[model samples]
Target: MACLLAVAAGYWVLGRGTPRPTGTWAMGALLGSFAVAFASYAPLVADGLEAIVPHVARLLSNCASLAAATSVLAISFQLNLDPVEARRRIRLRLALFAASAIGMTLLFAYEYMTHRSEQVFALYLLLFVSYLGFAVVDFLLQAVRQSRTTRRSSVRLGLRMAALGCVFALVYVAYKLTHVVSAGLNLHLVPEHSQCTSLVAVPCVFSVTCPALAVLLICLGLTLPAVVYPLSQARRRRWEVASFDALGPLWRDLSNAVPEIVLSPVDSDRGSSADADFMLQRRVIEISDGILALTPYRCRTVQRTAQSLTAADTEEAAAAVEATVVKAALAASKAGQFADEVAPPSAEAASRKDLRGETEWLLLVAAAYARVGDTGQLETVGA
Candidate 1:
């Protein structure tokens, strides 16, 4: 999960083209810092390595909290302010965090040198927990407010999820604050129990559960907006590809009969990486143009004859009549038999005003053309 968060952070921080006042970079820093800091919390020292690991973990704990506080401030101001004002605000936040971080480190070192004195330890914990609490609460409020007003559905959902994660983080903060108060003031709020049973205690349980849930929810939220658009585009592209292929047979027959109608020639490899929408629209126009070019050879007697043969009012029946007429016209043009000029009406009817409607009607016509074996039967009627 930590690795996942780190990866998400990298994707957002590095994958973008330009910086916007969206706090995206700060959010990435927050995720990356949080993951690294949390993963370092567990001491990995062997007997001889004790001098290093514990010290590094303690250092990271304080520094991570400081970084998170700075990140929260950066994010909040960036969203609401102009770049110059936001930069000014972030600079002040960084200065404050830096000062407090130095103080916290000094206090920790003193406490450690004093044989881990309870008084100094309590003071250190108090300072650390207070800053962490402030950061978490600020982030929670920002997330809630933005989630409500953000228009993009994926972004809104992500903000809401992140806000919920911040709620769990607040729980974790409260638990640590309770520990600090109990230890420093000699308050006996937390019961003394064995380590195993203590794990079931309210504070202990929250301390374990809240951070894990927070990380999971926050990571998922941060990544959703990044992934949704590409996935949706891929889905749309697939449908366009299928529709383009479905028009294949009809396109081939018409283009073969009137090759001049094709403005830009398409190849078998047209589907490799070209824009699907553009390709589909081009094919629709070419098919329409092919029908117009064949009008000189369209016999009125053939259209009437084809209509009589398939006179049902259903969409498929209508398509069949049109397909039969196209087949007969193509044959007449090939045989050097030109009919008297009569303005073609089928071209206008087939090409609807809207692209979507045109594509649907043309798909039906293509299907009918594929189903009919030959124009031999329809040609006899025209002759």
Candidate 2:
């Protein structure tokens, strides 16, 4: 349960921008339920106590639960109630808290006066616990129904998980109700048996088993956003950044060689005013077109040199070789060396399926031009 709370806290920090009323209430419910469940079974760890500690834990748990139910009720109705209605709700919760505090005091007093063992559920179990169970179940069912009717895939999936979590919570509450009735009537649901036969059977229907199972479901439902949302956002950011980095060199050098290839004027301050994705695409297209336009000047010596350098069988190497070949061809065209023009040969594929690959290839092209084509070979390409 502490682990679950930690996860929710992390998620809250990350997702503060888009707060949902339902999600807030669900987090409260998880925490409240965890406290009560943990308190019920704390005896296994410790030997002796005033016995009042568990009662106190149970009381605080009930308070948290009642508050959670109210939140869920508001969430289900989608009612961002006006200030007047909101104040009324707050007053009612305050009244419940006062009553609960008084009730807990009385329980402690009874234990102090009589010095007898106190039943944990003696403090208004049926009234509060049953209401909490129904309220949460109602909210989950509403969410599930709404999700079924909704077209959004992510909402539908998340709601279904919430519904499953609530079902487990319902089972846990059912056990609590059974305990309440049995305790009130002075009867054990797990009836004691007296028999001469040596065989023995044990029944633990009123045990912590149900609540424990419910904890697993609730924690899972609450923590998924913490895991999934951040990773998806991170991936998108990386893709955009990679695209810009890989295409930078080619965009710069090629645009310098043939200014007309760049469709839009550069951003005076940013050096490019286009959106990252659009700019990257434009750069790729413009460079390809310029290379095609210069194809008639392809030199045999330069193509052979490029083929040898690109023999490493990698995209990066191929891109660098291609850059050198293009620079040599552009220089030759400027010198009027190819008196008769021939059609350009079929070019190799970019083979860049993702942003990373695209970025790497483009960056290699830019870096190679900067490294080996610094002789200003394309200075007279248009002359």
Candidate 3:
């Protein structure tokens, strides 16, 4: 119980950044698992609680397992590249899981109520093994197929965790099968009755160990998100950094040239329309790049600027462009824009049509330059 609680807490902490839907479902499943396990062992803690608690615990465990399985399917759907394709796949998988779980539940209930024999228990064990085995095989095949086609680290990590979870399920099934088969053989190998059999088992072995194994499997399944989530976040951060770094030099040159071109008003400037266009393009790129490069720390600002830029038209656009650039520059310099909030950027500027794309590229470079205090390069360009 202590280990289970610890694992659940860890999951909650690690899952803080996950989408609300996924995190909520996963946490609910974890709590359900814990409730079931706690109820199962309530008998040990208090004899009076055993009769009612054990039965309730069994039912809850089954329900929790089903819920967890469904949640996993939902997460898989959410992670799919194409929503339509993902929905189709998830629907099929969920249907299959529901069918299997229902069948297994009916089989176990019937066997428990009718025969109440060790054979009935053995059959239940077999059902568990068969169901989980099928699930494992299907998931493994899907993982392999996804690995071949997608470069997404999250997808790969999710698949690997799913595989590991299936393996744990397999182990639990195997352990249950061994105990069921041993009991049916009438071999009193468990030593209390001392009957002869091929297996030399000690007394209370299954009674003492099987529940622990089940708990272990539950814990393993509950803790996987903690392992996979951090890696996914780190990978995403690194990708953003790399993308921004790629646009550094271009942004430096453009920022430096902008003041010169705008302030000097020379005949050369008329001929430099192409240069102006290029600089405008670079500005758009920079904003886009910055949007992508900046972490969650600047998300709201970036989003606001992006929305403003997208909505403005040509004449009004230049003001929006300048404002966004200034805001981004200030942000890069660790001087936040909140203190000097300007009117939103216009979407009508020469670069506003595709401003989102351009700004993203520029932002990355600006952020890098801002970090290193390399605006001197811009002066050199102006000179």
Candidate 4:
């Protein structure tokens, strides 16, 4: 109970940063239900609370599980997919889960009142196993679907966390099932034996431990972004500044070199066309250098893009130029340097493109360019 309260407090504090209404409400419901369930069992094992406590706890757990399930459904609804369809599915699932929870809660209450040993055990087993299976299946299916569709890194991280939660739930379910089967088998084999108490004790330990561990793990997973988001933003800002700083010296060098290259055209058409190409090349080189100076993370990507261009040009200058443009676009994508000024390849080639090797090369260059840009920015700021 104390551990759960601490987790709840932590979540509340973190929730202050971002208002995730449904998530917060769901967490609160789950914790509240857990507290009630613990209170119900703790008395039976330890200090021995009033007879009513255990019953109340059982009821609370059932209700809380229903509420938590609803919250998950709510999250799916708010995921910005097809809203009408999502809402419809969520409503249907929520209704079914609620009905199951209510029915189980009623059976639990009746069993407690009557003290019918076999029926009570059966009700508990069924409720626990069913909920565990349903939760795991639902969460994994949703996580897999989201992972395939979502482009956002943060969203993908969240989906991974959800998948982990499902796995944990599965482990808990399996542990419970093993205990249930062992106890049932023991009871069947020794109808008059009291040795079946050990089988019951095994399940008791699992019931207590699984919920506690699961709650902690799930809460931690859900709350991670609250801690990580700020750090990620800070890192991005630092990289941006460094990239700009690295570009300075390269830009100056290119500015000085370009006029000389233009004055003495290397080919017959070099005077007009070559000067433009030289300027463009200088800009690209400066950009690449800038990215290199900024962040070590993307340097290899930038280098690879540059290499692809060089190789293509070696084969056929015109073909190389065209390939370079395509490679640059792809490189920018791999580097995540989605600058508006960086044009994509022509639609015709981009659609039917067999540019695997070429694309990889460009991606490397773009990563390097982004790093240089960051380094340049840092230098400029520091200076």
lDDT of 3 by residue, 99-118 (tens): 76676677667765775566
What is candidate 1's lDDT per residue for 96-137, written digit by digit as tens? 777778778888788768776667767877877777787778
Clashing pairs in 2: 246-359
Model 2 CA lDDT for position 206 = 27
Candidate 2 residue lDDT tens string, 254-334:
566667787777563122323555666666677766766677776656656556655466655665566666667667666
lDDT of 4 at 155: 64
Cα lDDT tens digits, model 4, 1-383, are 74565467556646456555444554555555545544545535323443435545545554555555455545555564476776787677677777777777777767777874554656666675676577657767877788688776766776677677667667667765664565455444212222224423644434545555555555555555656787776775554344333333434333343343222333331113324434334444444333333332223443344444443333233223333343343345446665444333322323433333333333333333333333222111101
Best by TM-score: 1
Ranking by lDDT: 1, 2, 4, 3
lDDT of 1 at 58: 61
- TM-score per model over all chains: 0.63, 0.50, 0.45, 0.54
Lowest summed lDDT over 10 consecutive residues: which window, candidate 1? 374-383
TM-score of 3: 0.45
**lDDT-superior candidate, 3 or 4:** 4
Q: Count backbone overlaps in model 1.
A: 0
Better of 1 and 2 by lDDT: 1
Report the Cα lDDT for residue 198, model 1. 59
Instruction: Give me the overall lDDT of model 4.
Output: 0.50
Ranking by TM-score: 1, 4, 2, 3
